[model samples]
Target: MQRSPNLANSVSPTNIGHVVFGIGGSTSTWGNRKSYAESWWKPNATRGFVFFETIPRKHLPWSISSPPFRVSENTSKYKDYDKHPIPQAIRLARIISETFDLENKGVRWYVLGDDDTVFFINNLVDVLARYDHDEYLYIGMNSECHSSNSLHSFEMAFGGAGYAFSYPLAKALVTNLDVCLKRYQTLYGHDHILQSCVADMGVSITHEKGFHQIDLHNDISGYLSAHPQSPLVSLHHLDAVDPIFPSMDRKESLNHLMKSSKVDESRLLQHIICYHNPTNWTFSISWGYSLQIYESLIFPSILHKPLQTFTPWTKVIRPPYFIFNTRIPSNDPCQAPHLFYFDSHIENTTRGGDYILTTYTRGKIRGLPACNHSADDISKIVVFSPIRKHHLNGSRRECCDVLRIIGRDAAELKLRDCLENEILP
Candidate 1:
C-alpha cells in the first residue's frame, strides 16, 4: 500500500507516530456508539497523529454493512469472532509498518487499541517519554484472565484495550505474523493467541500497571473518579453502560458525582446493592438459585452475627462483622478466592473501614445453618481459608488465643465447629 503524499507531509515525518485505533461494526454504529472517539478523540487530535481502522463485521453475526473507516474484511469462513481479531491486528500493523517505512523513518512507536478506549493524552505522553524506544514492549493494562508461565510470563498485552509497541518491535511482530497465521489457524482468541505467539518467539513483555481497561460493569462512577489520580494512561470501557464522557444520561450523573467528590462512595454503595441483589441475567443465570440465596440472605445473616455478639463491649472495642462464604465458585477448587469482613472499630481506623474476617475450610463445607428458623435441613458449606480474614489487624491472633483458652485447634476450626453444631442445629 502506497502512502498518501498529503498524509505523509501533513504529519511530521520525524515525529510522526501512528495510533491505529481499531473500530469494528458498521459506519452508523461507529458514529453513534458511546465511545472514546466520540468524546475525547477529536479534542485531543492535535496531540499526536490519528489513524482509524474499522474491522469489517462480515463473518461475524454483529453486522454486515461496510463501516466508515478502512475496513479489513475477514474472508475466512471462521464463525468465531474471537479468533479473527489478532490476524486483523497483524494485518493492520503490517499496513502501518509499510506505509510509514517504519525502519527508515523515525516513527518511534505504534499504539494499537480498540474503539472503546478513552485516552488520557497528557498522561500517555508522559508515560511514553520514560521508556527508551529500542528495548521495551509497553502494555497499558495486564489482563486478569491469562496466567503467566515461567519461560515467558503472560502479562496480557491489550489488543482490545490500547497497547504501544516500539518501531522495531512492531516491525518484528508484523514480520512474525506472516509465519504465525500459517502455522496456527485454530488458536482463536486474540489476546491469548498474541500472548502465546509473542512468548514463543522469545519477546519479553513488561507490564505498566498504569494502563487499565474498563471491564467492570457494576461500578462506573467509582472507576472514572479514580482515573485522575491513577497512573493508568488509557481506560478501556469494554462493558456496556460506560458513560464515555458527554453522554447525556450517565455523563450528567458522573459530573454531579465528581463535583461532590462522592462518586466512589456512591459507586461502592451501588455495588453493594448489586452484589446482594443482582438484577442482571449475566449473574443470576450462570450460578444456580441456591448460590443466589446464599449470597443474598444466608451469608449476610452469618456475617452480621459477630456484630451482635461483640456489640455489648462497645466501651473497650466495637464488635466485628464476619463475612463468610464470599467466594465465587470456580470450575477448579484450587484457585484462591476473595473474602472480606469488618469491625466497626477497625472500620473507623482504615481508609476503607471494612477488614477481612477469618477464612473457612479449604474443601467444601456442608450443613450450614439456615437464616429461616423453620428450615430443618442444614445446607452444605465449602470454606476456603485464604479467602476469609478478620477485621482487626491482630483479631485473628485474639481469636486464636480465645480458641486455645476454650481448648480448640485454631480460631477458625473452633468457629467452624460452633457454626456447624450450635448455630446450625
Candidate 2:
C-alpha cells in the first residue's frame, strides 16, 4: 500500500488528542465497569463518550474523570433485531456510527471498546502513530482462544479488546452501518457484525498484537508475562480472568498495574529475558506485571512461549488451545517457575542518567523444593530500565544483563538494546 503524501510529511504527530473513544456500555453494567474506563480515560484531555442504553438510574452523579455518557439511539426500528438472543449487539455494533455522527473535530481515529476495556493511553497513541489515519484502515486482533476464533472468525476483531477505525473508514461505516446492522441482526456478537460490515466494504482487519481480547478464563499470568513484541494497548474481559496480580481483587490488581503503567505505558508487560549463568537461572520479566524465575537455564525460544496457565473460554476443550505457542506448565521442580509479582517502582536520577527501579516481591511459596537452591533465597527482584518508551518496531526485543546479586533476598538487572549481532544463547 502506498503511503499518503499528507501523512508522510505530516508535521503534527498523532497523539491522544487525535483519537476519540466510543465505549459500549449499558445502564445495568456501567456502574460496576465504569472504574475500568476511568482508569484510562482522562477528562477534558481525552475525547470520547460512553454509550449506554439509557440513563443510569442508580449510579447518579457521574464523575468528571470518566468519559461523558451518550445514550445509544433506539434500535427497535431495525427488522428482526428483537429476535437476537443478545439484542444489545445491534446497539453495541453501531457505536462507530454513533461516535462518527457526533463529528468531533480533528478526529483521526475512532476507538471502539467495551466498558471493561482498559486502554493504556500513551501506548495506544504510540501504536496508532505508526498507521496513516487518512486511509481506510481497520485495526484490531482476534481472540486468544482458538475456540472463540473458530466460532466467530479469526479475521474479526473482538470488540471487548477494543479496535480502531481510521477517519475515512469510520465515515463510510457511519453511512452504511444502520442497513448493515439490519442485515446482520441474527449475528450474535457486536464484533462479528462490525467485521461483516467492514468485509462488505472490502476492508480486511489489520491485526495489531497490542490489542488483547483476553478471552481466556482463570489465571492469565502466562499470557501477560510473555507478551508479543508490541506496545501494550488495551486489555478486555477482566471480569472473567483471575486478578492480574495475586491477592488483590480484580479492581485493585488493575490499580496496581496502573502504578507501573504510569511510569512507562509502552513498557507495561513488555517481555525481557536475562540469565544468571552461575546459577543457570533464567529471569523473565513481564515489565510492570510479573516476573518468573527458572532454576535452570531456559533458551529464549522456550522462555518466549507463554506457559499454558489459563483455560479455554468454554468448557469444551479441543485441539489448538491457544492461538500462540504455549508450553504446558510442568509439575517437575526443574521446570516450574518461581513466581514474583510487581511490588513497587521509583524513578532514579543519578550521575549517569535517568532510569526506573521496579521491585518484584516473591508470591506464595510452593511446597516444591527450589532446584539446587539457586533461587530459594531470592525474595525480590529489582530491575533498572531507561525512562523511555521501548520502540516496538525495532528488529528485536531489548536485551537485559543480570547484575550482581545485591543481597541474599534480592537480585538486580539492567535492560538495554540488544547489541548488534548479539543473541541470547
Q: In model 1, how large is the Cα lDDT of residue 43?
A: 35
lDDT of 1 by residue, 1-425 (tens): 12255544554432223343333323334544434444444332322322234543432343223112454444243233344445544443334334334233445566655555655444454455445555545455554222212112345565545677666666676667645544544554445455555666676566654466443343243233222223335655433544423223554533332222221121111111012222110001000001111222223233221111111101223212111112233322222111221111111122233222222111123234433221112122111111222121111111111111112111111111112222211
Q: Using lDDT as the measure, which candidate wins?
A: 2
Worst 10 contiguous positions by lDDT, candidate 1? 281-290
Question: In model 1, where do residues sit more than 4 Å from their true spots?
Answer: 1-28, 42-68, 73-104, 144-154, 222-230, 238-248, 251-425
**Model 2, poorest ten-residue lDDT window?**
78-87
Give each model's whole-structure lDDT: 0.35, 0.87
Instruction: For residues 44-160, write the lDDT of model 2, one tens digit per residue.
Output: 799889998888767778789889888898877774555544668888887888888885689998999999999998988887888888889999998988888989998899998
Q: How far is 77's C-alpha from truth in model 2 (Å)?
A: 0.7
